[model samples]
Target: MMIHAMSASALSQMDQPAFVAALDGIFEHSPWVAGRAWPQRPFASREALLDSLVDTLRSAPRSDQLALIRAHPELAGKRAMHGALSAASIREQLGAGLLACMPEEFALIRDFNTAYKAKFGFPFVIAMSGLWRGDIIAAMARRLAHEPEVEFAEALAQIARIAALRLAERVAD
Candidate 1:
């Protein structure tokens, strides 16, 4: 699982498969975002690469977009409880202190996840890189009140933010 330190210049020159391999995990379980955005390569900067990837997700079909959103696991939910999250998600959630939650905190988050999913038809999503679990819970509660369309857009934006953080970690500035 060694990640070679690939410069932006080096990454820009890669073939589609290579490019996707280097960046596929940045968007949780959605490697197709990078695969589809491969044609927009030769990025002049890391920001450009990020913009291309996010743009690809933004322009995807609704079904594909929903699938991408649904690809994310619930916070402190079954996946976290069972230790089944993807490596990227595990790191993000663990860093957010989700793995350290007390039983009461876990139950509160699980309840929020169930109610939120029931109402919105998707799990709550947020860029958890620097967030505390409490802050995440607060935000989730607030977003539960948003209209579906608004929440959908917000989820995509949060995914983009998560991707941006992941890109910064993996790619050179």
Candidate 2:
């Protein structure tokens, strides 16, 4: 697939559907974030567009927020192991070295995935760009202890970090 990069000015000029399509993959499977934030475009900077998108997610109802979080596949879990993740997810995990774990670490991460989901009702979501598998494991261990409300907030923050990274990749300063 070809990645279409354009100036923020050009992106700001797009019609709604085109804008939504352009940013479709930024939030995993939730293009609605862009769609809902569409009217806020002609963004003065990439940061403004990012703020709009993240704000949309932040203001979403509880169920929708949960849906967005749940849309992300577990790290190194079945979907990733089976190669079913989105391109950005693949690169993020592969960059973090989550895809090449030793057997022991892999099993531990799988266990964390199961327990974390059972506890929080959503898969663990982290921005995996500069992290190593060990860092991910430590983060999972640490975040697993958070209360549901706290964890939920943390999840959104992490998603925002991820969106910021992705937006930077697709949009220029």
Candidate 3:
């Protein structure tokens, strides 16, 4: 029975390294994200799997989304755990090295985080892709102006996008 299952799994994985790699990479970084078994079965098609993963992520509650966001460190700070996130994610979070250049923006991020959390009960969430420090600070200011209900929905949507991109990287083409 074990041999049969193993053989079935091996057959399912044929010519699907990219898909397997994507899922493995995500699980390696965040094993508890969805609380599923490791070495997940190979996806039949990349698009279908990505769609399902996005749906799964979108369905997650706000608390779950916040947990995932909190797993990420501040964009530029000593507390950042470098290897846990994608390089692009790290760069975006750090704000294209602006945090190194401007101390005030760092202060702003700290203040915004406090205010945003006090107002919305969750950390500020952003995709952080292709964003510079000034851009991030600007976004923080703008988002700070949002009502809790608006911000909560936006945060979840952004989280879903981030998860989808991460999952897509793992799926077979």
Candidate 4:
């Protein structure tokens, strides 16, 4: 079903099943985000709604966060076998090809991934939107130097930002 336009009040009046179904449909392309539960009551405004979504994402259990991180494939190599990522994510992965143009950057990403996983037991996480390949590699390299606790917190924060953006788009205007 397509949701062209929906007011907040109209959306709130929907039954539980219908509301979940609508959210599922809108967010199906990004199941990691879809798997999260919505607030019990309607949010008063877009900002309030986004804030809640961000909070949920930030406070998600470590297992959930690790699952989300593992769901993402290495940025510059093969595409993920999973079918649920958004088009934006796919494009970002593809765009990482630019890293290949610079051998040092490519090597840096590889090394950083290794060190990051060794330090934190998970892949490095970053929101690839609005970032170029060089910028991402640079950020990865920098983040590689962070303490495990600091990196974990930073990764969670970036994930929240990404979730907030996705939630904002799915929310009825």
Which model scores highest in TM-score?
A: 2
Clash pairs (backbone) in predicted model 1: none
Candidate 3 lDDT over 66-172, as tens digits, reads: 66656555555445434455554564555566446466767777787778778877677777656676777788789989987788778767766666555544333
lDDT for every model?
Answer: 0.90, 0.92, 0.57, 0.60
Error of 4 at 50 (Å): 1.8
lDDT score, candidate 2, position 155: 95
Off by over 4 Å in 4: 1-11, 14-36, 80-86, 94-105
State the displacement of the C-alpha of residue 27, model 1, in Å, after optimal TM-score superposition: 1.0
Candidate ranking (TM-score, best to worst): 2, 1, 4, 3
- Model 2's number of clashes is 0
- lDDT of prediction 3: 0.57
TM, every model: 0.95, 0.97, 0.66, 0.71
Of candidates 3 and 1, the better by lDDT = 1
Clashes of each: 0, 0, 4, 0
Ranking the candidates on lDDT from highest down gives 2, 1, 4, 3
lDDT of 3 at 114: 78
Give me candidate 4's TM-score against the actual structure.
0.71
lDDT of 2 by residue, 1-173 (tens): 23566667888899999999899899999989999998887798888888889889999999999999999999999999999999999999999999999999999999999999999999999998788999999999999999999999999999999998888888877
The residue pairs found clashing in candidate 3 are: 19-171, 19-172, 22-170, 75-93
Residue-level lDDT tens digits of model 4 in 7-124: 4565566765665555542322334443354544576765665565555656678777667666555655334334444565665565655434466766667777777788878777
